[model samples]
Target: MRLLPAALSAAVLGAVLATGACGAASADPRVDAPVPAAQVAPAAQAAPAAPAAAQEVLPQRQAAAPPRPVSSGGASRAPVSDPGMDAAADGLRPFLLTPAEIGPEFTAGEEPRPDPATPAPCGGPGVVAQFPFAVRVGAAAESANGLVQETVSVYGDEAGAAEAYRASVAGMSCSEGRVDGRPAVIAPAEDLRADLGHDEATGWRIGGAGFDVVMISVREGEVVMNFTVLAAEDGLPALPDPLTVAKAGTQKLLG
Candidate 1:
């Protein structure tokens, strides 16, 4: 598993404060804005999307190209039945650390509902899910530290995953919009690297007012994974670095 790590340093944190990027919107920024016709799943309990168009407008690199098969050695390559996608979630749980590992104040939240049409914090739209099955773990933010969420999707073949990865990389460029009803500015995560190993990966920082959200998207083999963290700008306890979380996730998924 080739994984690029996104490390947060003091200089990066200082820059974020100076920019005042994606702060919460006041009374909602653009109520008249056309919601993506696809209708995003309400983020009520899910991780909110980054500020950018809900639909991906960038030209994806050869989306139809098939992903190269991962070197599986001599093992047989037989796909197994995954009813209701529970097996997929079970496979990913080991990659993410528990609340106890993060801190005593943290508590686990319910599994996130599948959001088919929401824009990803680092990636654009729901391109990650090329096949019908996907699973998500919602944000767990009972603690004052911050909120964290992750989603994983299995593509039927490598091409879908490759396409999704291409879209995510394209989103690294900056864009402004109202995400989940709040004003936001999304741009490349220059402070933290997005390419955490493997074929394709990218990161983004969506900042606003006194709050900030960081996201990383990675594609390994036939899997597309996303990790996001949101925290208050100042005060309270220090939040977990989203890059570390994403690295760990890709390691587990690809190793």
Candidate 2:
């Protein structure tokens, strides 16, 4: 995704810092700022509407087949049931939702599955999921002077997955660990900016700037999904928290 350049003259910088400090306390950093009138490219389009939920099937006994007619005068016919076709169809049903329909909000740029023939990405080894929501953002590095690239993944969950994700993200700056045991890394945004100066364009405000980046993951049955937000930093002025806005956007997915 492309980052748009916001006007950041000295006057704007001073106002941003003053306002940003007050924004630090809010749940989302972006909320304080008016939602930009211009259409910022959405990380991705809203997902398409989902198909109607599948209907439940009841158990039933198979009927016995009648004997076949003699070949000499019989009409040609084919069996209605095919186990192989049924299995293939069943395998593909879960992945039918398009990426937009899979989540409330997501980033752009879908990766090509290792196997193009299959709709799903490669499963098993190094596979985060048959399908996963991937969002990318540019954040400040440890110095706060430069930018770093980060990717967040949303996945299907089982048990202990949410806690595990939190722990994994917590260990990111200090340890070599991965989200869901896949090779990845994370660093606290505040810690990254400890020494460097803040810039409005990069979305880092110094001193009174109270922004916080939080990692959130939710688990429902078999789905474990993760996302991040920059929260409103309290003690400042009117800047909105980025995290809070992100959370509000993703919360719709739970419904």
Candidate 3:
């Protein structure tokens, strides 16, 4: 999902920027390319003939490319969601969190749009590459015990949904750093029970520097769904279970 909203308790650097280690780790040992027997035979036969002036060439390693932001419209296609996101409403409504779900004082905020006054994670391509269509809605309250929740729905083909899922996992796995000067850390969920996505998922809790947040994103057939809930550290009722919210939304979206 996008990072925390401006209403976020902490004055963070925001969210989703510098968190975890970038690449995956491996344990296999590097092997050298084999030399032609005939080429090495003469050198072996002779007393290691005087070291040749020409040096043996080695394979060069290429640098890993940075994650490219997903773009829209090109020579071949109009855009991911070329026609528009008209059909996205049905898929997004289920995930919308209501004021009742939080506290009575909390009221519905503005619906998430392409360019909202507050920085929101509504862009499909940025978070999940090639997610042609997406929509989001949020709720907020300014009472002493405040709360914030944003639900995002992304629509695409099966492959697009999978790509989004992978990105979310990486985001949570590697999330760590300071936003707006407050510390942020994302730890794997200890008990995520939702039965959504390709396989069971690793839930996430984002907190530190007075911010309390929980997030989860899942993929089903052709849609990727995300839910994030936040509240001040000293708030009354604690943040509800994110997975529960996700399951409820998935049922409606799929139905």
Top-scoring candidate (TM-score) = 1
For candidate 1, write residues 83-177 as lDDT tens digits: 44454455445554566655576666433344334343333443322223333332233244455555555555667556645654553454553
Pick the winner on TM-score between candidates 2 and 3: 3
lDDT of 2 at 102: 23
What's the best-to-worst order under TM-score? 1, 3, 2
- For candidate 3, the per-residue lDDT at 60 reads 12
Cα RMSD for candidates in order: 13.4, 24.1, 22.3
Clashing pairs in 3: 11-180, 12-179, 12-180, 13-179, 13-180, 19-176, 20-174
The candidate that achieves the highest lDDT relative to the unseen native structure: 1
Ranking of models by lDDT: 1, 3, 2
* Per-residue alpha-carbon lDDT of candidate 2 for residues 174-211, written as tens digits (9 for 90 to 100): 21121211111122223211221211111222111112
Say what the RMSD of model 1 is: 13.4
